[model samples]
Target chain A: MKEKEQMKNKTGYIMLLIVLGLYGILYFVHAGKTLQALEATFGVFKTVAPILLVVFFLMAFLNTFIDEKSVAKHLGDDSGFKGWFIALFGGVLSHGPGYIWYPMLQELRKKGALDGLIVAFLYARSIKLPWLPLMISYFGLTFTVVLTFYVLVGAFVQGIFAGKIMNEAKKDR
Target chain B: MPRNVQRLKETSLQTFKTLQSIAPMLFAVMGLVGIFETFVTPEMIHKIFNAHAIHDMLLATTAGAVSVGQPFLSYIIGGELLDEGISMYAVTAFILSFVTLGIIQIPLEFSIFGARFTIVRNLLSFLFAIVIAYMTTLSTSFLSGYFS
Candidate 1:
């Protein structure tokens, strides 16, 4: 168990090294653009940092004050259709890079949230209402409507498929 | 005061631990995505979708899978691609792939979730993205034909 965790912790640093190595090659290929890429990296970091801090604070607050019992009671394994609705609503409401949501989802799962609902939630993030009007304006009403419908439907389908697969995989482990 | 202070300390410690776990992955993802944005400019996006062959949908899909950004931006990009005379099939695949697949973020994803779950979910999403895009093309042409 200890070795497993140490290996897990090393993964991020290894990935970082590989990315930097690519950037090194990119520097030789395009010196000016490589500088811009470094700036963009900082920009991405700035955009994500505050939001991630918020999530971390929320996690701490919940860990300290809110018991998992309450969250689990509603979104737990038997949460059914209602749980799906909750998850979708939450996802649609969510904003920012999807990576930030993964840790939050893991927290939700530990609180007994259904696997399917979590997957559905991630898929639903595609339909941001603020952008819906923009999408329609660009893609037109009919195309927007059809695409949005498929996205919503796709979320549920993705959810069910992910849920079952993840569960079965876990059981095998 | 002592008990409350201890409780506060524990929560602070927990939050720090959370930040520790998150910070590395966050930085790694940001670094790669920054490079992607720098090199894969809109001009490049236009170039990537050049082929009009029916099978070129896969090429468009591959581009989409690699690129990551706001879903709304993809619509605007898709519109621009449409205006560029790219085939509907390729455009649709690009839009769907933009939202669903995340080749760039796979490392971060795998770090949080296990390998099996991450691979399976992404593979399923990639397949669905293709199917959804294909259906959109088929239906849109059918609608245009019927209406006209």
Candidate 2:
């Protein structure tokens, strides 16, 4: 366990180093663009930071109030359509970078959450509820509605495919 | 009261640890997206979508799958593409791909989900984006035509 934790930290540091290296390269080669990029990064950070907070709070709440058994009961391998239907909403409500949700998902995995439901959640994330007004403004109401519906369907398809393929791969092992 | 406080501490600690674990990669990803944003202006994207040829759907979808941006921006871009006379297929595919696939964020995704799940999920998403885009255009236009 100690070794695995160390490995994870090592990977994280390496990735951070890579990002800093790229930033350095940008600074030297294209200083103006680099500044603009940094500015852009700041913009993203401003938007993402709050979402991250919410996600963390949600995770903590899950840990504190919700037990693993309940999670498994709802979204487990045998969770059926009801589980999947709830997962779509759960996923959409949870926002931020996909990585932000990884730890939570990892927790759920330990509790036996279905990979299919997870896939559906992530896929459906493309169409955020808050962003709908803007989407409708640009694509018109009809297109936005249709596309959102398709996205939901696509997420389901993705979940099913991931579940089947991952299951098969597991069996092969 | 003491027990509640202790539980709160543990929860906060766990959330902090989770954030610490992924913060590096997350920062790196944002930095990269920032740089990409500097070069890949919306104007450039606007110029790229007039191909309207037989393989335009693939072209649009591939482009969308590659480029990474916020969903809101993609919606606006989709609107611009429509104004530029780009076909609905390309526009829809582009928007779908833009939201669903992340060529730049693949490393982050791969790290979190592992190689097999990441690859399969992304590939399936790419294909589905195209299919959905086509279906979306067909349905919207077909419905209006039928109703009209």
Q: Spell out the clash pairs found in candidate 2.
A: none
* Cα distance off (Å), candidate 1, residue B26: 1.3
TM-score of each predicted structure versus truth: 0.89, 0.92
DockQ of each: 0.58, 0.66
Write candidate 1's Cα lDDT for B1-148 as tens digits. 7875677679768767656765676788899888988888777778766556466688888888898666776787788888878877888788878876778888887877668767877887777777777787777777767877
Model 1 residue B95 CA deviation (Å) reads: 1.6
User: What residue runs in model 1 are displaced by over 4 Å at the alpha carbon?
Assistant: A1-3, B1-9, B50-54, B138-148
Off by over 4 Å in 2: B1-5
For candidate 1, lDDT tens digit of each residue in A86-126? 88888888877888878877777777777777777877876
Name the best candidate (by TM-score): 2
What are the lDDT scores of the predictions, listed in order? 0.78, 0.80
